[model samples]
Target chain A: MSIQISDPMLPELYKVTKIQENTHDTFTLEMVPKNKTKIFSFLPGQFNMIYLFGVGEVPISISGDPSSTDFLVHTIRAVGTVTDAMSKIKEGQTVGIRGPFGSHWPIEKAMGKDVLLIAGGIGLAPLRPVVYYILAHRSKYRKVVLLYGTRSPDDIIYEEEYQNWQENFDITVETTVDNTDSEWQGHVGIVSALISKKDFSPTNMVAIICGPEIMMHFSVQELVRREVTWNDIYISMERNMKCAIGFCGHCQYGAKFICKDGPVFCYSSIQETLKRREI
Target chain B: MKMLKTILENHPSFQELEREHLKFVIDNAENIEFKAEELLFKEGEKADKLYIIQSGKIAIELFTPSRGSITIQTLGLNEIVGWSLTPPYQRSFDARCVEDSQAISIDGKALRIRCEEDSKFGYELLKNFTYTVVQRLQRTRIQLLDIYKIRT
Candidate 1:
């Protein structure tokens, strides 16, 4: 179902169907529209402004498979007052959702080219939808390489999914942890370290990165070192988004409003702004 | 010797070294392989060799009272491991093979003597090792930040 934007600012009521704890601080919320028959449709990388009754709202990425129209999914970390409250919300509770906003990962543009997905920490939430899209239409793309990094082995989200993607699909999935105990046998290093593995060609590749700003910066540098062009590289930027539209200056980075102009942007367009110390 | 020289030439760490300097280092190096689960060196052991990984993975680990053995880092194909070239050299962590691995192990003592005999070769080796050290340090710093952890 396509998104029905009756009012950009007003949120529609949605009933929480399930909540799955991904880690100590991260959880996935599955919700469906309370009064509408149509499912909430959104492109990969777009976000929804999830609101609790008395508490405020926060922008969270749409993390579910786009083809699955049964419910909308969001993977969020309980990092602030609003998100902390949202974490305690029970299944069957009602919440407000306003969007499907911001730019999306260029899945269509990436057709016939190698797709590189690099995600760090909870940054993987925004890129999960893109992974689902690529898996559904696997034949449309060339080599698909996913390099994910987390704080530790326990912090890794979608652990079984990574194994499935690696074993079942014709994709290269390399997961690294910043630190790990002896029980963890996987690579232990920064996410950027995995780039040198060179499982996919840099030529004719579309790279999508979403992570802590510093992590993204270094990952971009490594990709560029491997000859991936700036135009072919995309990044999802996070900011304090109050309004899902350009009217609010809260999410502005340089002249671009992250909520409207991006969340997903070609790295070539904002490399300069990204380098700025404060914006 | 020719094969070892070729491997060193191809490795990014030693690729830019002067031909004679490369040859000098390779002279003190020999091909070695370790099976999966083999311990290459142990913590506090006399650090005698530096391994230039040709293929496969090796974990640099530290043993803690609580965790037993926690991996500090994993070095893979074309990477360098071990760097106790100074006096009173001792392995700071245990290096164990995570998979069947091949590398060129350079005798640290021989290489140190070679460095003293030839300052140019010493400078070259120092430069390359310094680069590796810096890179590892930067990666360690990033890991220390726990960037993936949710910060409220």
Candidate 2:
């Protein structure tokens, strides 16, 4: 069952090591190579093609810490057929993992600058690794702030880890829930509102945003108002990815491919493509 | 009500108020404290006062039929807790203390009257409240978008 990762097309078999419910509908999955001791590694913003037996594969971001070599982790919200089926699978099941693909977040370039991480809903799954990397090597960066927004209080992911990220890692984590629950006592507004309330200077600040396309679009606008240039802001784009190898036209956005050219890209690079309402 | 000039100057919204109008607000306002779980106001009540939180948190809530009480927002220090503008001024949501909290309560009636007497001050206050209203409106719009859902 231990398979090699040299062939980027054929997925190496991996067995689900752990599974946990992240929210009412989303789940976090951990997998390790079924036969091989070496599981493929990934960068913060990269993803893998998760294949469900007899079903299909979907491009899911690698949500685990890059520094930790133990197992590969992914957070999946059961929306479509494949993901819904994957969500129903129990631990100790076999699945296919075809990558650690795509360009990574600009973690290295962000060194010595203030880092602002903005996530919306399940979008946090992709950005969680960036936070982890920053926490692991906190000395490399300046102030790190995470502004996360969700639909309602119940939709938050990694609720238990937020406290530790704040207290131990010293990252500013501000969360907002649009709707209310008795247990939720936080800001009730868009993440942009929280950005206004913050004092992060746009100078020498790099912002990494991942969320709904619309939310990401607006977050960039707000940051621009705060003097963050489009060049310094990066966003993770999601599209219909089939090959993830750039050969397939399924993931094209203008000249770039969402799977190969990005999943992570600077705002300035794709501003034109992003503006097209229907595309 | 003796006021700290720094307090007024520190908040972005209050900072925009002319000094005299700022002083007028401080003079008309009274500091009050509420214990945890205490209700400051309720939905459908006449908008009598607006509270600017000095410290602690206030839960802006609504009574949901399915979920009972749902807190829509938590107002903290330097944040205003009540919105009362123009006619038919009525509280749309419940306000409760999340923790032992201190805030300054500005009488809505007195504020309206002051605004009427001083047209310039009235315009300034209205302008400030407009920002608040628009901000809340944008937030509401995002909430309606359910930006977090797996699919739109």
DockQ of each: 0.75, 0.55
Best by DockQ: 1
lDDT of 2 by residue, A101-143 (tens): 8888999989999999999989999999999999889999999
- Per prediction, fnat is 0.81, 0.79
TM-score of each: 0.94, 0.90
Q: Per-residue lDDT of A161-188 in model 1, one digit per residue for the tens?
A: 8877877778788888988764777899
Q: Model 1: which residue pairs collide?
A: none
Candidate achieving the largest lDDT: 1
lDDT of 2 by residue, B29-128 (tens): 7778899889999999999798888877788888989888887667776778775757778888999998898887878788888899999899998888
Clashes of 2: 2
Give iRMSD, candidate 1. 1.1
Model 2 segments more than 4 A misplaced: A1-5, A35-39, B1-3, B17-19, B30-32, B64-67
lDDT of each: 0.88, 0.85
